[model samples]
Target: MSTRSHSAVMLRRNFKHVARNPTSVFNAVLMPIVMMVMFVYMLGDAFSVGVDYVDYATPGLMLMAVCYGLGAVATAVNSDLTKGIINRFKVMDVSRGAVLTGHVVASVLTNLIAIAALVAVAFLLGFSPSAGLFDWLGVVGLVVLLGLAAGWFTVALGLAAKSPETAGLASVPLVMLPFFSSAIVPAEKMGPGLREFAEYQPFTPVIETLRGLLAGAPSAGDAIAAVAWCVGIALVGYLWARAKFSKRA
Candidate 1:
């Protein structure tokens, strides 16, 4: 069979594994919802961004949801590796790229589901967005790019880990970075040192770009920076994962 055909098989296998795990589903879907509720109700009125706090916070919440949803990619890849399934696949002549492709695609699909659910709940909670058709398309495109970048990066981490437990923690930093970004608070509001970090971090451009898109005023500079960062991350992740897979598996 062709590599694409093999990838499809692997994809189905990975998808089934994730679907059978309730924890994975909760992390991808419900975690975001819970965070959204907590942030909106607990601190919504405390902030005074130019827009409503709910609207101000949605972009950040979506980003956290994406980060949380993708943690399983590393776990799944590590599970196959630690269980010797990768060696079995090798003996069976499975394409290496196909195996990795399966994990990456499955991860992205999980995040897509999580994003959809988050957006729906956001609407119910009065999260108003001003994006037009093109803006919405841009948002989806940017998010998918991020997922691809994160998916491949996590796959590399998974391949490098000695166990699935370590791999499962690979995405924790990503999940936490939004808090230090402009997602929940403006960079200007932060202390001098932290404000600098907040302004320069990758997630800042991402959240800024997304927020601008949703607000109907996408900044050319932030959008360019966000896309550049995503492309760079994806490229780096692809090379690293391929090298690690070749070396180890």
Candidate 2:
């Protein structure tokens, strides 16, 4: 079979895995909603600074949702690795890259759905921002890129893990990354050391870009930086995962 056909078959299998195990999807959607609610109701008035906290926070929550979805990818990949599924595939005539590609594609699609659910809940909670059609499109594109980057990175982690538990633990730092970024609060408000780290970290520029796009205040620099970070992460992760897979296989 062609590489594309191999990938398509694996993709279908991954989707069925998702269907059989729905908690990953549920948790991906739930974490952001719970965070949004807690932040908006519990701290919105204090943190909003005269603007709508929901609007100010929703972009960050969306990004966090993407991060949360990575945990699922890691878990799924690790399960397959540990359960000998990958080993079985190695004996078959499957395209070498198709297995990982299938997981990445399915994880990206799942993340998009989680993002939509987060946005819907945000709107219901009074999160509103002004953005043109093109802006929205840009936001979606940016989000997909971010998801791809993060998903691949998690796939690498999953492949490297000896067990599913280790894979889940490995992704904890990714979930916590946005908290240290400009996602939850402005980096300027942080201490000097932390501010520097938060400003320069991978998640910061992406969060800022999303915020800018959704608020109708797009920044060319931030957009460029976000895309650069996503591409860089994706390339590194793809190479790392490919090498790891080959070595193991």
Clashes per model (N, Cα, C within 3 A) = 0, 0
Clashing pairs in 2: none
| lDDT per residue as tens, model 1, 109-176 | 88888888888988988988999999999999989888888888889888888888988887678778
Residue 182 CA displacement from its true place in model 1, Å: 0.9
User: How do the residues 111-226 of candidate 2 rate in per-residue lDDT, one tens digit apiece?
Assistant: 88878888898888898889899999999999999988998899999999888989989999999999999877889989989999999999999998999999999999999999
Task: Return the number of clashes found in candidate 2.
Answer: 0
Using TM-score as the measure, the top candidate is: 1
The TM-score values for the models, in the order shown, are 0.97, 0.96
Off by over 4 Å in 1: none
Please report the TM-score between candidate 2 and the true structure. Answer: 0.96
Worst 10 residues of 2 by lDDT: 41-50
- Residue 188, candidate 1: C-alpha displacement in angstroms: 0.9
User: lDDT value for candidate 1?
Assistant: 0.88
